[model samples]
Target chain A: MGLSLKTAVAIIEAALARGHELRLAPLTVAVLDAGGHLVALQREDNSGILRVEIASGKAWGALGMGIGSRELGERATKVPHFFNALAAASQGRLVPVAGGVLVRDASGIIGAVGISGDTSDNDEACALAGIAAAGLVGQTGARPAEA
Target chain B: MGLSLKTAVAIIEAALARGHELRLAPLTVAVLDAGGHLVALQREDNSGILRVEIASGKAWGALGMGIGSRELGERATKVPHFFNALAAASQGRLVPVAGGVLVRDASGIIGAVGISGDTSDNDEACALAGIAAAGLVGQTGARPAEA
Candidate 1:
């Protein structure tokens, strides 16, 4: 089943709360449905305008690949040349880093949540918080539920 | 005083190289002049179809505002409600996140690069790589020389 918009919002809200508690810098959060369509997006004021896109891109990548952005980053490190070339080939729509988590319900992959405006590790933490708040698991594996 | 097409291409090339090295999935890359004009675009064969638009949006936001997309992301956090409304108002053209970098030459703001397909953090890394490849600094607060 596809990720519900309501669930996506809940995830975002929960993540924001944690960010606030941590006094993390302004953050941008985006949730993409299984189909990769944007279900919800929130950009905090004082956060750079680009955070919205960054958050969305990460989530989009995760939903599209059924994996975490962190995995993509690790891969990029191995083949720097090819990854750089692909960056040019994609026309500026590929990001492979942490801070994005795939959303899953009992059935299967539902959607994804991406966070920006903090360190990569911190971004991932916020994303995990969002997923946990939704009462779902944020997992990493060879075959994640596809969007 | 603007981002030359050649430099833009080089930036994309470097970004892709990084992606492949890490075995990250396909990606899309986009570069924009300080005026937010398209300079170069690329999409890998395996990249998702939506990456193109996402990349463009991030670059556009960066170039339009003359700042790193990451900075924009922070601003969005303070005024999340307004930011959300603005995202809707922009009709998907505005991303406002950290995956985009403002390109700067000795003269000044030349262009911005945006990369998608991986994660927002990965996208930002690739964008930074492209900036370095172009022999320019991706500064947060700089106006375009041409402007």
Candidate 2:
């Protein structure tokens, strides 16, 4: 099944609420369906304009690679040139970063979530909180030390 | 406010419904935010594989130029070289055609909706119908003869 708009909004709201609870900086969140198409997005006031692009790129990269951005980041380090070519090919849509996570239902991957504005670690933590709050799975590498 | 997934879906559904009503053909509809980010897209069964890209390019061009693709098509005819340069600069993201319509709210332009899979006129008619059905404004220079 596709990611419902209601669920996408819930995920965004939960992420914002978690960020508020943790006192993280204002954040931008993007939720993309399996095809790397945006389902919903939110850019908190005062968040830099680039935040939305960064979040979208991260989520697009995660969905494109079928893995979280943290794992993609590791892979990028191993094969930088290939990823660079990919970035050009995708028109700069791929972003190998730490705050993109795969969203899954019991059936399998349904979508992904990306967050920006705070440190990558904190952004990831907030994304995880939102995914969990929505009763969906968020797949990523182990939490970083800062998170 | 940005285009929500719910509204995007409504647009797509309405377009597809109109397509069926007219018995044009299976269609593909794409919705993009003002930032030219994919909000949601659907390729109807039996629609050509390229329909998605065509729809996206139309919407992207409309959002990028702050005008409907019909107007963009007219401008392209007037300055083919400039339009060609824009296509290169945008990496083929812009399609100066007749099926893209701008989506506006009371405040201002929010995004665009594009449709493909039938004649361009029929596609634009469906897009306009979708935008209207979604409770948004759809602006184009004028209805094409066929539409």
Candidate 3:
């Protein structure tokens, strides 16, 4: 099944609760449908204005390429020159790093979540929490065939 | 001085060349002035339709906020609520994440470049090349200001 706006919003709310209970700093959360369209987004008041863009970019990248941002980050190191050129070419939508997770149902990828503000590990944790809250599997542990 | 159309074209050309040389796949490139207005855009054959929007959003966010997209990515972690609201409010124009860079002359920020198709790192590299071709510094290292 495709990711619905309802699920996306639920995921964001769960992430917010986790951050608050853990006393984490402000955060930005973004969810993109499998087709890489924005479905939901949220940023805290203390978060920088740019967070909105960053969170969206990460989720977009993950959904666009059908893989985790962490995998992209690993590949970037192997080809810095190419990666640099691509960064410029992409006009800033590509982010090759952790803190983003693909959402999966029984069928396939449904959507993605990207969080920023805390450490990468923490951000990923929040994403996972949100995924679980939405009653979907957080595909962080699954390796895409392309990866 | 604002980034001229000529400079923006130069950046796009350089980025395209790099993409071809690296065999990075079809891509889309966009250039924005310091104020986040579009100056030029190019979408390579076979690239997805959404590539144009992704690249444009990245560059627009970088140029509008006067910082690298990576910094914006970090900020999103702490304040997702506000970030998502802004993304919705921006109507797909704002993207905060690594893969876009500010174009800087000796004086100050002239514009920005954003590329998409390959990995985020590769897109960033292409933007850097375009900035260099335009005889400007690619401010990939600079972080966005805190909100």
Instruction: Report the CAPRI category for model 2.
Output: incorrect
- Stretches of candidate 2 off by over 4 Å are A1-27, A33-49, A63-66, A71-91, A107-110, A142-147, B1-56, B73-85, B103-136, B142-147
How well does each candidate reproduce the native contacts, as fnat?
A: 0.00, 0.00, 0.03
lDDT of each: 0.73, 0.83, 0.75
RMSD in Å for all candidates: 14.2, 6.0, 12.8
Model 3: per-residue Cα lDDT at residue B89: 38
- Model 1: residues with Cα > 4 Å off, grouped in runs: A85-91, A140-147, B1-147
Candidate 3 TM-score, true structure as reference: 0.51
On residues B89-120, what C-alpha lDDT tens digit does candidate 2 reach at each position? Answer: 99998999999998988777888988878999
What TM-score, over all chains together, does every model reach? 0.52, 0.62, 0.51
The alpha-carbon interface RMSD of model 3 comes to 10.2
Give iRMSD, candidate 2: 6.7
Best by TM-score: 2
Clashing pairs in 2: none
lDDT of 3: 0.75
Candidate 3 docking classification: incorrect
Kindly give the number of clashing pairs for every candidate: 88, 0, 59
Residues B59-78 of candidate 1: C-alpha lDDT, one tens digit per residue: 87775444667777887674
What is the per-residue lDDT of model 1 for residues A1-147, given as tens digits with 9 covering 90 to 100? 577788889998999999998888778899888887789888876565456666776676676567877776666566655545544444434455677787777887888888887776788888889898889877443355455
